[model samples]
Target: MSAAFAHGLIVGKFYPPHAGHHHLIDTAAARCARVSVVVTASTAESIPLALRAAWLREAHPQAEVTIAPVVDDVEIDYADPEIWSAHVTVFRHALALAHGGAPEIDAVFSSEEYGPELAHRFGAAHVGVDPDRGRFPVSGTMVRRDPASCWRWLSPAVRGHLARRVAVVGAESSGTTTLARDLAAHYAARGGPWAATRWVPEYGRTYCEEKLALARRRAKATGLPKPWLDDLEWESPEFATIAERQLLWEDAAARTGSPLLVCDTDALSTSLWHERYLGVASAVHPRARHDLWIHTSVEDVPFEQDGWRDGEAVRHRMDARFREELALRGLPHLVVSGPPHARLERAVEAVDALITQGWAFAAPL
Candidate 1:
């Protein structure tokens, strides 16, 4: 079997790529040997054009398609030929850049009434895929209004961008990991989209374990005495590395997780940890944002050294520092103390309130 068309074209704002847009792109890819997906956004739109292009590329990695982005802030006026020409100019340039020059487009795929006009401008045939929106029943307009309602219709990349993130930060053995895991489980037990809920473990612990193991291996090779876990040294750059890796893992989880993502620790927490070990403030900064922060209190919690803990005294100082930094930054957070179950209960309530409040998106153009 051979593809019916040599080349196909798709152009849209793709404010936030949804399932419907993917279907249209898939439809074109099945019929054409090559497809060019042009993502055009106005300057007034909130979502970046580069981000839209990246999402499309991620969503259609296996498809034979080129995702191109171009910015156009021209006023729309369907009834005026001059405005239509201006819009076509932008589309043509996008396609040309994707191909290094304009390729003969044999088909234009869309789910809108303007499909025919778009194809005619490119001297190609119009292929409409579910123009009535009967299949996916979703739109950029609907998603922008309340993304949570249309959570199922979004791609993982888009979901990652919209998902609400909760970071649990605290001293060692303060039950941060326990609380994060419990919160994720509470949401996953819902058995719908929530079934995919995910929790990101603290990356710093893993980094430290690996660092200590490497040093021990080197010492053994040279006949030096095995160094204790607490003997591992910390460098300023290492904190930045840990923070960067933490965000990478968190982002990966958010992409596949439910609308609510729980992280055991975040980059902001790394900054505090740096100060605890180095006795000075760190230059490390967080690249990502957390919607809610849950500080696990060391009070009433017995500090159990898992071979990596810095003991009860250090734990208390770290816990106090965490609280102080959270307050100084004016970040939204709450402290959870007492037994594991009690801490879990309070964390769950805070998460419930966050989800219930809903997301507030900037108005789209």
Candidate 2:
């Protein structure tokens, strides 16, 4: 089967990349042999041009389309020829770079009134998909105003970037894992988008176990006694590795999960651990941004020795350090004390309030 056009071009701001944008691209892909989806964004926009293009690429992996990103800061004014020229220059540059030269465009697919003009400029036919927005009644403006309302219209990749991230951090054996799991379960029970809610477990603990196991193996080879967890040495760079891996896990989950992500511990906690062991501030800076933090108190929680704990004293010191750092950094957080059930209740309330407050996006130009 042959396509109607040899090469088709579709251009848009794709502020957030919603279902409507995907529909238009799909429509063009079906009619053209090859499609070039050009994403444009200004410095004033909240979402980056590259990120928008990446999302489109992720959404249409099966389609024969190329995603190109361009940064156009010129104000959008149909009446101003100067502004039009500036935008067209940016678009042409992106197309040229994507094709390695000025490839001939057979058709220009768009949903705006300027489609004909854009096609004429490129000596191509004007192919309008859905000008009335009837097939997919959504726009970038609608998505930016209230993302939750148009949640279904967005792909998992975009949802991951927009989801409300809640980090649960505290001392060892403080029920951080339990709280994170329960929080994810709580939302998953609601079904719908919440059904895919995910929880990121602590990666440092796994790293510790692996390190201790390696030490034990080395001990056995030397005919020495089996090494305990306390025999393991801590290095400044180890904490940075833990922090980096923790964020990677969180990002993977966010891209596959629901609109809410629960984290057992984050990179910030890794810094505190580094200080506790090395007696110095760590170079491991947090790379991911969390929307909210929940501190689990060790008030009534028993320090269960899982064959790899630093004792009750260390737990108390680390708990206090978490409290101090969270306040010192001016991060949005809440401390939940008491029993496991009670702590979960308070965390749920805080998370509910966060969702109710909704996401705030800067107005796009």
Number of backbone collisions per candidate: 0, 0
Candidate 1 at 318: error in angstroms?
1.0
TM-score of each: 0.92, 0.91
Residue 168, candidate 1: alpha-carbon lDDT: 96
RMSD of each: 2.2, 2.3
Cα lDDT tens digits for candidate 1, 1-365: 79999999999989889999999999899899989998988888878889999999988985589998999887877778898899999998988888899788989999988889989988999999999999999999898887877889999899999889999999998889988888899889997778889999989989988898899999999999999876778889999999999999988998888889999998888888888888887887867669999999998888798888889888898898999989999999999988888888888899989988877755554
Candidate 2 error regions (>4 Å): 60-64, 79-86, 130-137
Evaluated at residue 79, the lDDT of candidate 2 is 76
Tell me the TM-score of model 2. Answer: 0.91
Considering summed lDDT, which 10 consecutive residues are worst modelled in model 1?
Answer: 356-365
User: Tens digit of lDDT per residue, candidate 2, span 133-206?
Assistant: 99888898898887777878888789889988999999999999999999999999998878889999999989
